[model samples]
Target: MAVSFHVRSSSYPSRQHPQAAHVDEQLTRLRSSETASSSSIRQRLSNLQDLHDSLEKMIRLSVTNHALSQDQIEKVLDGSIKILDLCNVAKDALSQMKEGLMEIQSILRRKRGDISAEVKKYLASRKFLKKSFQKVLKSLKTSQNKNNNDALAVFGEAETVTIALFETLFSFMSGSKACGKWSLVSKMMSQSKVTCETDANEFTRVDMEFQSEKSLQMEDVQNLESCIQDLEDGIGSLSKSLIKYRVSILNI
Candidate 1:
């Protein structure tokens, strides 16, 4: 006779283990938080890029219009000041982006003790972007400082030239008795030639400096553009890494 056999199912949960469920819930929250943070960062970066583009256009226009009218100069200066304010805003936004990434990284490390390779990759890209952003900021600051110094030098030189011209005109109008003295006239003519030559040399130097300043500004702009492109690529990579990390966590 064959004996009858009976099997009982285990009391423990199947796929829905409590520990696994907790992990999945945590992963979901992290994904949600990071998604929001990334979106904010992207928006800020876009704003920063737009501001940079506008500032560049302004600089180009101002540089090209060498003979700006007084009103135009005032307008340019005002616009530049406004652009600088916007730059500060962009800088703040960039800082926030960095901080947000760092916070997220820290949280992930604390929770997991060790993050995934994709997360590590994202962090590295973010760090690189931060460095690049700083370089771009420094380049912009240097360009602005140089432009300001060059403007001051040009203004001072123009004032000196104008004063010299007026003084010479006034001397002639006073009808000095020295005008009849050949030695005195010769000395005056010699002094005038020296003054003219000095002024000419100064003017030439100022022109050269202005050209150099323009070239430097152009270089700064180009560097910033390149940096921006790199930063964009880095951001894209970071975003992809974030998505991959989320997917990996879900799979786990």
Candidate 2:
């Protein structure tokens, strides 16, 4: 679900962070980024970083504590926990996929190990991870929070956006759910010239090629390796921002 983090004009006139509107702009861009391609996901992560940076600024103001009750704070904490879990799982998958990619790269480079067997094992591991990620992805719903025009509401909505973004990314990683689930993104896809930088399903392509009469290529392994590195770096940065966010809310 998309959310604007700008403080509402009506809600006790919450203290406004200078970049709150900027955060909303980033949020809009992220919502429109329907494809979880490596480039798009990296862009989304950059937007998330900006949004969270604004959040940290907003957190420092007195209104943050006044707008939130103990119960509401706990709710935010629950969502925060989910965000960390989602982030961690992604990190784990990327790490594993990178390791597997390296193994395949080594096999291609030195003709070490049964290449076909190693390829099969890598594909199988990815398939298993995809199956497991399904459950986690389902929990990241597109929220439609009413009266969500204030910063406190934004805090919760931020969590929703975080979840929804991850849902799209993981969906791409699994290569299962079509973009149609997010109707706006699907609709924009036809008009959008920008798609994934090397689609996450590139691994599936590599696996398919390996299974075919055609032998493995170093180019395939290297391309996927580059994509994974991009994702890993983005996720690591997001993870740090998310942790700081958790700390900010608690201190409030």
- Quote the lDDT for 158 in model 2: 71
In terms of lDDT, the poorest run of 10 residues in model 2 is 180-189
- Candidate 2 lDDT score relative to the true structure: 0.69
lDDT tens string, model 2, 163-187? Answer: 7678667776775534523443333
lDDT scores in order: 0.32, 0.69
- The CA lDDT at 82 in model 2 is 83
Residue-wise C-alpha lDDT for candidate 1, range 1-252, written one tens digit per residue: 011112235984334323323333432222122111223334433433332333223223333234345554554444334333433434443344444345434654476543344334434544554465445434332111123333232322222221222222222112121121112222322323221111222112322333343322323333323433444443444334324432332222
Q: How much does candidate 2 score in TM-score?
A: 0.81
Predictions: Cα RMSD each? 34.5, 4.8
Best by lDDT: 2
